[model samples]
Target: MAHFLSESELSKIESEKGKESVKRAVKSKTADVDNEMRDIREQRARLVEERKKKRPQTTDKRTIAEIHKEKREVQDEIRRIQDSISCDAKIVLPEHEST
Candidate 1:
């Protein structure tokens, strides 16, 4: 037999579903950001070590190019994280109708 729910009940169910979806999305996004931040921090630490080995070397164009490449990679990572969070927020899980 088919049953009907009142408007308030329907709305409440929808609100709950939406809240849960948002919570999951936020958690996923937070995890991704934390992982990426850790990776970037590790890379920066390595860069620092490279800088500290003050083996007075000539200014090489390749070093300059590598630095720029690293900078761009970091920027891209940040942008990807932001996009992931935003995309996650836009997702709406299909609501299951109550029996």
Candidate 2:
């Protein structure tokens, strides 16, 4: 098969393909991170609820300090992931095309 593509054209096409792959990879990673954050939030909410349901007259499932500590850890984890991953689709275009 004969192909008609200049070297520069081929380079551009290859770069475009690479960008597409990068976008997909970033999207997948972002989703995974977002899901992890959501799970952490849900876990923290459950902990808060469980801690609040203790009756003064009965044995509690967990002490207040323990619940607070776990909640804080979860919050920290969420912040860590949020800083490392962008939930938004941050597609990075080639510099020449960015303008």
Candidate 3:
């Protein structure tokens, strides 16, 4: 004969399963964030390299300004990603709360 779980036991198993699901979701999100951060850093490095090269004779103030703007935008994006990661780290799951 198969054993049936009581209500409390079933709820406990469900809660544990939910917690595992949440943990997997969090890990997946974190991995995605890491990949994004890596890509942004690579882009930032490329921008720096580009800035170091000599500009062509036809290069104008507008072009130079645009490059600078792009660099600033990349920097801002890095900071935002970092802040988001830190904020995410601080989150407390409801199921993790102590009674």
The C-alpha TM-scores of every prediction are 0.37, 0.39, 0.38
Where does candidate 1 clash, by residue pair?
none
Report how far off residue 10 is in candidate 2 (Å): 22
Please write out the lDDT profile of model 3 over residues 1-99, one tens digit for every residue. Answer: 223445785566557778677566556656777787888899999998897785545778899899999999999999999998877766754446746
Query: Where's the lowest-lDDT run of ten residues in candidate 1?
Result: 90-99
Q: What local lDDT does model 3 show for residue 55?
A: 54
The digit string of per-residue lDDT tens for model 2 on 37-81 reads 888899999999888887356545678678889999999999988
lDDT of 1 at 33: 75
Q: After superposition, how far is residue 24 of candidate 3 from its true place, in Å?
A: 0.5
Clashing residue pairs in all predictions, respectively, total 0, 0, 0
List of clashing residue pairs for candidate 3:
none
Q: Which 10 consecutive residues of model 3 have the lowest summed lDDT? A: 1-10
| Alpha-carbon deviation at 42 in model 1, angstroms | 0.4
lDDT, residue 22, model 1: 55
Candidate 1 lDDT by residue in tens digits, 1-99? 223445775566558778677566556656777787888899999999988896576778999999999999999999999998877656643245323
TM-score result, candidate 2: 0.39
Q: Which structure is stronger by lDDT: 1 or 2?
A: 1
lDDT on C-alpha atoms for all candidate structures: 0.74, 0.70, 0.74
